[model samples]
Target: MTLHTAIVKTEENKISSEEAKKFILSEQNGAESIFVGRVRNENSGKEVTAVTYDVHDQAVIKSFQSICSDAKSKFDKNASIFLEHAKGYVSVGEISILIAVSSAHRDEAFKICRYILEEIKHKSPIWKKEHYIEGNEQWLPGYSLRPKEEIK
Candidate 1:
């Protein structure tokens, strides 16, 4: 079953990595994998100021849910999946997103977890704006939805 797929919007909040860890353990599968993203102190030779995240309210979340549902069909009905992505100002070493998946075997769990992470980065309407040390902010180039790339 697809469960705990979420996109958040706020100033800043701590993501409970331990909660995710516990959930993964409780699922009790033969294999498990986790992906953890962190905010860094430096980027492109610039001192990192902070990152601002903005995501399409409904569409991004629906996309997340769909990823889980489809993975379940291929892997196993008991395939456990979870994702938590952050929004707003994030500092270095803070968790940006946590993805954990478990399956009956090692290979299937690894593939599903990796697939979900990349699919989220590519397909979700989540955008990030970089705050540079020079007191300038810029949205990631080529990330803004172009007219031609509308999800029609």
Candidate 2:
């Protein structure tokens, strides 16, 4: 398969890089790019204790597939892509997102990896609530549902 995508429930399961690597590996690929996004200890001047990800599962999955397919069309058709995002409570240092891409060239591998990430950020229905060390939590602003042309 050229694409694999899922939303992993952080409470029971964690995103694994090894699995991503294994999935995207192919004899046809000459370059591999993997991106691991972790829940940071700080965000916007606050000490972040953890993060909770809420997802519209069906929409997110559909978007992931579309995004990966678009990336392949735009870059390399033979590219293999693996993408997974976390849901539920994710502690600091835990993974929030993982993307792995393998292609025939380094440039295509890198572009596909980055394209998947950026598209997910803008198009996926995933929300984040950050927990601060001072016993406060706030839902951060996510991507606008409006079309890009209509936003201005």
Candidate 3:
């Protein structure tokens, strides 16, 4: 298989880069690129203690599949990709997302990895609420799932 994708619920498990690496490893691959996203300690002057990710699981999986396919078609047909995103409570320094790609060249691997990440951020039905050290939380603005022309 050229692509593997998932949405991991943090309460039960966490996103693993090692797993991703293993999934995308190949003897034909000359280059490998991996991206890891983590819940940060701060955002916009607020001290972030944790983050809650709410996702529509089915839709997110569909989007992930589509994005990975598109990335492969656009960059390299033989690219192997592994993508996973965390759902539910993720503490600071904890992984939120992981994308790994292996391909025949450095450029193709990097491009595929980047394309998957950008597409998911724009197309996935995932929302985030940031928990702060001050005992408050706020929902961060994210890209709309609707087309720009549809929003009037």
Candidate 4:
């Protein structure tokens, strides 16, 4: 199984779900599951104009690799994982993250894809600052990693 992970800090482009899907396509893997995260137009009832993501690139990459390893261990060792996250400004309705997993069966692919996304949200050191349409801005904290007992 192959693992591809990236933290893109450039504003030249956004995370592409198609590209991720294309990269994860393999003849050996019959099932491919994908999860795409997009910047919402509103958050907590406030209209959001954009979201700027700040990340410790090295640390996030390491965390992502570890997440992929965990997924492999928990799911199928032969599954392939592809994860990508945007590090700069993302406009409303734009893609911010892409996760793709391929495995021999649908169940493993689905579970691994979900697990990687959840881990990224909880464990990765990526910060997001939301810009409101009214010119207000605020940094939001992501959810903390769940304890071992909390994980099923």
Candidate 5:
């Protein structure tokens, strides 16, 4: 069967920009929106050297599928897309995640791309281990799970 979209590949899989571009362009569409998540050199006030990503494998992939499925339902059509995340050690300038969406119109692509990226950040089971300048690293907590009811 022809894949409607791809939400496969776990933490061990690495994605390239070329792959994302190809995935988004394969289908004949008028427009596209591509979002690339990359590793930067700073987080909070710390100077980051690299970021190690980890995921609760099954949950991460499931979350990705749900995103794609939801987009299709909301948009009422299949969008050409590539959803990828990484694991192991990723240094600065490396791609941590990539999302590309192609639709008949730019609005659909942009809307879906934005929705996917934001939702993934808020909902995915992936965590980040950030390496700082002083030779220290720390694993981050998932922000979406913060109990707002307990914040008070």
Candidate 6:
């Protein structure tokens, strides 16, 4: 059975890797690859107190679906894609995002999981702010996946 891709909205909710795994697991898929992103305690020698994420839900979900579709075309069409992202303050070591991919083969699962994660980081309409222990905070610049010619 072909599963509908899941793009979970985790606003004010903690991300769960187990939940994502359960959602993507299937009898037909022999292999599953998961990627969990956690907030680190430090960045560039600065002590990180917390990290917060703000997302444009509609746009991000659209982009996520597009990425999933691209992965299905490039990889295995039968693969299941599951993605979840936190949308509020997350302390160090807490999960920030989860990507799970399941396919009949291990290679396809691994490749699609990586592709979904990279696309989300570089293309999604999600904004992140890093709060430092020194009472300073800065918004991180969003990376773009588009080519220079496509950027306005």
Cα lDDT tens digits, model 2, 31-108, are 999999999999989999999999999999999999999999999999999999999999999999999999999999
lDDT of 6 by residue, 58-134 (tens): 88878888988899899999998877777778888988888888999999999998899888877888888999998
Best by TM-score: 3
Candidate 4, overall lDDT?
0.89
lDDT of all predictions, in order shown? Answer: 0.76, 0.95, 0.92, 0.89, 0.77, 0.82
Q: Which of 5 and 6 is ahead in lDDT? A: 6
Better of 1 and 3 by lDDT: 3
Can you write out model 1's per-residue Cα lDDT over 120-139, one digit (the tens) per residue?
87778887788888889888
Q: lDDT of candidate 6 vs native?
A: 0.82
* lDDT for predicted candidate 5 compared with the true structure: 0.77
lDDT of 6 at 135: 91
Quote the lDDT for 114 in model 1: 83
Candidate closer to the true structure by TM-score (higher is better), 2 or 4: 2
How much is the lDDT of residue 11 in candidate 5?
48
Candidate 5 lands at a TM-score of: 0.84
Tell me the lDDT of model 1 at 113.
88
Q: Please give the clash total of every predicted structure, in order.
A: 0, 0, 0, 0, 0, 0
Q: What is the lDDT of residue 89 in candidate 5?
A: 83
By TM-score, highest first, what's the ranking? Answer: 3, 2, 4, 6, 1, 5
Using lDDT as the measure, which candidate wins?
Answer: 2
RMSD of each: 2.9, 1.5, 0.9, 3.8, 3.0, 2.5
lDDT of 1 at 127: 78
Q: Residue 97 error for model 3, in Å?
A: 0.2
Arranged by lDDT, best first: 2, 3, 4, 6, 5, 1
